[model samples]
Target chain A: MTEDTKKLLYVMTNGPENPDKTYAPIYTAALSAAMEIDTSMYFLMHAAELLKKGVAETVALKKGGSLKQFINMALENGVKFYVCEESLRDLCNIEASDVIEGVRVVGTSTLADLALDADSVISF
Target chain B: MRTECSREWDTEGELMAIINGCEIPDELHYYLEGSQMTWIRLDGENATIGLTDPAQTRAGRILHVRIKAAGTSREKGKPVATIESGKWAGPVHFPVAGTITRVNEQLELRPVLINDDPYGEGWIAQIKVTNQAEVAGLLKADQARTRFNEIIARDNVKCIRCQK
Candidate 1:
């Protein structure tokens, strides 16, 4: 790891369309963790629906595996997982404890802080 | 000429095969110029990469897989992931220099996917290559199978997944 390594901020906005869009950001963030780069993934809008218990485990990409599987990979490897607090409440009507173990529900300011700190940001 | 190949699609919809005695699918690209056993699929600057059937079979059934983090550029022919099997342990190297976009995180919990489905669900990484032309320089499909047959024969290697 170097000071120059790019920290990634991945914004996931889609959810359960095919229930498959969620996989990309989680996979990307997990890969960033594997590369030992600093990384964070923020779930926004309908994407917050994925954090509801039992949803992620059931969604698997054709060959990429399940969302829970991907999230576990991200969590085990130290990628920060977050759900938009506003989105969680306004969209899913859920609280932080409603999310799976690794996710934290935070406000937009946290999202901004993470995005600005990242050397690179991508959205899915 | 396309080598004769027979694949048994796993119950979960992935493909695997043992051509002659070693497993080498007829679809993956081969970086065989210097005789590396990596497989890559180049579409523009993005590529999906993994080990050839022969390489995976030689490694035995992978018991674990650990890939490097994404968002980092790797030089061509550098180690990207490490796999441990009951009989052998080895590194999965990339065939081109690029920033790794993703890894098959499925392997962390089910490392056996490498042995069970190396080409599909078992893929090592997806790289955003710096040079797509470098990947174009590698062999594809039939050419890869032909080279794989020669290598398997030369080394007298025999590979079988041995699923119960």
Candidate 2:
């Protein structure tokens, strides 16, 4: 709703297994930012793997172009992006160094912070 | 309620149209004094403002609107509101200096009215004039009609979907 002026947190937990699911976070995040709403997304579990270098570049959703294009579209509009640290290690044995530039890898405490600050949470 | 700066809305003027399909209603005041896309309608010292038809057509389907709050003072050419489509985002600049009286609340849920009816329900804001002289600089109906026709010809743009 346009009257909602609070922050939004989108949890992008669905990874490339169902490629169609990956686009909604970026699409919605960017549109919200354009409307001047505060918005952010968290990459948890398998979705954390998407931030691994070379992963997003290779993943194309049903919408055609690379998913990274959509991710960049969100970033360009100022939607903050974060990745879960535990998921990087537990799910894929990936490290913070492996993530692409612009994505911040943080601990679960950060996710908690996001959850507390957000007025709405969306699980994608 | 007509004033030195206010002109009554002309029903006959609404019938005039650009040969190429741009609808520059004769009664609406096109703000030629600054950047040219915003239109104004003066009712006494108050006014309603919105994008010109060509502007809405150019923007495509607007999905969201964020207008300045009521009681905010706007300077000429400053943003009074902003709108976005999936592919584009831009501000709707004020045509004259005034204090905002109201915004179209319905736009929160249905911004496409900007594309559906640029002239009527799509109006972005109502302002209480603080400077009537600024309003004086606005284009009158005959001039606005001619100027908007020229705008359509020069920009080579067609009016998009509009109901009445």
Candidate fnat values, all: 0.00, 0.12
Off by over 4 Å in 1: A1-124, B1-23, B33-35
Interface RMSD of 2: 4.8
Task: Give the clashing pairs for model 2.
Answer: none
> Which one is best on lDDT?
2
Residue B89 displacement (Å), model 1: 2.4
Every model: iRMSD:
9.9, 4.8
Q: Each candidate's DockQ score against the native complex?
A: 0.02, 0.10
Model 2 Cα shift for residue A14 (angstroms): 0.9
Candidate 2 residue lDDT tens string, A22-95: 87777788766655578899999899878888888888766345687667667766688899999999987898
